[model samples]
Target: MPESAHVTEEKTLSESNPFPDSIPERLRAQWNFLIEVDKLKTVLRQSPLAAVERRENDAEHSWHLALMVPVLAEYADEPIDIGRTIQLVVVHDLIEIYAGDTPLYDAEAGRDQEARERAAADRLFPLLPDDQATHFRELWDEFEQRRTPEARFAKAMDRLQPFLLNWMARGGTWQAPGVTADDVRRRKSVIGDASGALWEAASELIAEGERRGWMRPGQG
Candidate 1:
């Protein structure tokens, strides 16, 4: 096949839909933003998918967290707006579409993770329409600050989702070098801030992992 023929075989998203010149500017911006975020599906994380051999991507992680909100909201430490919590979780990691995933166990990467994500948020959020851009950015901010009940529960779901995945993976990231049961306990303890019940469940799983020799007890 000729190079010109091959070029058409692999079209970039913008090329896939050659928008008409008459299309509204607002719709164009919105469509472009949606297409850009498709990159989220490519940003892989440390947690393995429960049913798959490969790591989950940011898109899958965010979707799992959003789905978990309704199922687990009843366990929250305080009442939260379920819809708002879902929104927070959905937007929380979209910044990762640009900043890229920082694995839970990577302390060196974590040291500058916030700075990188903040810069990402600045660039990515504005891709939406002005109103949606502000709203989504605020939702992202709330999830990061974790000040509101919705944000807290959203964050708890975020932490718990990977914890559940690791258990399903039979230790997943728990098996990373030098990672101990106590380390898992300390990192996942934040789940308690929003749901003591979920934390208790998670605690049991951590203990079980230790008992199974998946992780050492570390300092504790």
Candidate 2:
């Protein structure tokens, strides 16, 4: 037989038995969910990467937030379950893979943001097997609510990551028109609720940005 014929035969066999009967159904479902969620790497957010090469994608953002949880957990106003916080951050922005990232300062985009993300969550989470789908959906909801200490701390890191990036880049997003020091301050106020120490550090960064003329001055 020709080499081309042999290649076609192998492709057909693999397609017929993509997963061997030995693999459990639940494990296959989990694998499929993992593959589907990889699309998050293509969903770009408005925040610039620390290197300033381009906008950071949802996958990188989620990973960075997850890593920040341990390093910054001590700053949380109350004790938090670090494991839960890590899980929360990892899955928190997965919905953006479908709904798309909404820029923080775009008031026009803010109106329907929650509705759009909720719909995306509904469409995406069920890709997992039943139990995992429910668990992930609940974690995403908890992070959004910001009621628990873990959620609050997770939210703080979400805001703080971009804040640090912008400041490091000499006001990457802060340079956008109409983005005053007060605007940045107002947007990041939730960090204060999580930890006064973190809030003070953010305040110092903001002041430095303003002093360097990287941030626009607020109106008198």
- Best-fitting candidate, scored by TM-score: 1
What's the count of clashing pairs in each model shown?
A: 0, 0
Backbone clashes in model 1, listed as residue pairs: none
Report the lDDT tens digits of candidate 1 across residue range 8-81: 22233555786676889789778877886787787778889988699888889999988999998889889999
User: Model 2's lDDT to the true fold?
Assistant: 0.83
lDDT of each: 0.83, 0.83
Q: What TM-score goes with each of the models?
A: 0.91, 0.88
List, residue by residue over 102-208, the lDDT tens digit for candidate 2.
88887777788898789878887887899999999999999999989999999999999999889778898889877899999999999998889999999999988
lDDT minimum window of 10 residues, candidate 2? 1-10
